[model samples]
Target: MGRRKSHGSSKSKQHVTHQRQLSLAKRNEINALCEKLFVCEYAFHTALSINSAYVTQLWDNYVEISTILEKVKRLEEMKTESPKRSQGIGQFINWLKENGANLDGASVAEFPGYDLGLKAERNFQENELILRIPRGLIFSTHNAAPELIAILNDPLIQHMPQVALAIALLIERHKENSKWKPYLDILPTTYMTVLYMTAADMIELKGSPTLEAALKQCRNIARQYSYFNKVFQNNNNAVSAILRDVFTYERYW
Candidate 1:
């Protein structure tokens, strides 16, 4: 009986060790894939000025890279049973207060159903300013890279605020040690927008009018991105900064 118990314990220990090894291996694989994706992204940006056909191929590669990145990010999020905001979030709120935001009666709180939300600390009268966020704290295309800003100022692209903002948001998102890092850290890594949903998820919305609208918006944004890619292909500065195929339906939504 003693021998049997000892053998069983050994087996259990081996099993646990195997699981840890598998987890480590998976993590290493993901890291390798992420590196490859970055390389692909760099190559795609470099090819933007070559030709339309080559650019299209590179764009497809970029889409694949993005899709894989999204999957890995989702997997990482799922592994965490209880997701908590980073310390940067608290700093961000403090920064907001210091930068002229007024948080008097309302405080940012975590609720059961609503994730992070504004809650009333006390009874408030009508028309009272519970919270005030300064305009400078807001992220917009106006603060995008100089190259992107120049492109946005173009007579043709200037009229398309949505496209311009989406591009700017993506550019800022990829920046290393960005000024908005604190706020960006608190932002969701994934969205429930129709653009990111799988076909099975879309099935839930079958026959809904909003689905058609979502599809239309996707096509319109893709068309706009394509037009801009062709028009700015000769501009090396703009083309180098521009991330092709990033203006996805998810980004627009």
Candidate 2:
């Protein structure tokens, strides 16, 4: 009999192609919506400035556009589904095992408030080892790209170790096939940090002693981001490309 074609591979290729097309279409739609939303926002602001009669209409349109933008964004994200918890965690566990990690009695579990919790599956005696992670497995500026490391070492940058590490992480996160993809995939998309909270959300913290501290912290971070943005803007290098997106307040928080 004649050789049979591999329909599985063909179908896989078709599926990938279809997904790409869908993603491109969604991106185009989002772009169009964003342009319209921008115009609406500008009109609303203009109306407010002159105290125009159409202020309410413009404001309503702006709100509607914002809602649609959010829905489109969510749809795009759903289409580009992140790796499942089991898949990402399983991959990390396999990697650890391959690297001679001693994760015998320890297992990952989901808690009520806490997202992921490390639990001891079995009873451990005194002085018994539960889990041991090798230093080599950790991601740091040391293991980052040579160009990135050079940037971090530059006197002009003058960033602390944590800042350098943060920049390195942002660069890696932007890469399509990053080695840390599995690990990064598990990170929370949105944090409950004060930096991310809306004004309405902040009202819940009224009468709290930490409210002032949180506001101060937010202002400090904004200043730092502005400083970093100007510093990197002057340097026209690959480092700037990475650091450009890294100095955002949201990223810092």
Candidate 3:
């Protein structure tokens, strides 16, 4: 081979080697980061479940959260049957204890609700809150370990959408109430997943331009608001109220 060709070939080989190393390193870093994030997310939701106040709200609007409860039950059952799956759950919790240090840890103070750390600049769009996901989602313990992963799996979340929709519609429908109005300011991360799932379902079912428009609008609205933390503020009462007023099984039935 000519000297110039040989030199180019050597450089190309080095570049390929470097690229491979970088890709491996990136994947490892992402995996580590995801583990920590799963913990933080799990801790927040776990905190949400423990508070009596939220539980009472859920009870009052029993129908709204019925789906969510079902999904949780399915997940709980999976954990019981599979030790490896359960171990993933444990690792997630440990990650929370370690990495969630910086987030607001005043679970007692935030009773019935907690914020996962997400910052949004002013006038962010609605779709920003809507999780980007592929259809037909399924989650095992590994994906469930991180909160984001769980959120990604939310559409496949089994039973949460009806309740989530009730909450969102309540906020949108009850535009007059000052207290309830703010809840609509941003969709919660959990609810955002539900919304995406719902939209995805609708897209698949009808493929209607109207539904497509609605999904697009919802995403745009989400972007304008920022992440769910600023908007939701853990208002279980708000959720309950929406569930009671807006959603009846008959409507879905």
Clashes of each: 0, 0, 15
Residue pairs in collision within model 1 = none
Between candidates 1 and 2, name the one with more favorable lDDT: 2
Tens-digit lDDT string for candidate 1 (101-219): 89887766667755566779999999887888878878776654445755655654577676566556555544444455455545655555555655456556545546545544433
Model 3, span 193-216: residue lDDT tens: 323344235445243334434433
Please write out the lDDT profile of model 2 over residues 123-224, one tens digit for every residue.
999999899988876777676544575465565346466656666666665543555554554555555666565556755655565654554444444434
Indicate the residue-level lDDT of 208 in model 3: 37
Query: Using alpha carbons, what is the TM-score of model 1?
Result: 0.54
Which candidate, 1 or 3, would have the higher TM-score against the true structure? 1
> How does each model score on lDDT?
0.49, 0.51, 0.29
- Candidate 1 runs further than 4 Å off: 1-87, 143-147, 153-156, 221-235, 242-253
For candidate 3, the clash count comes to 15
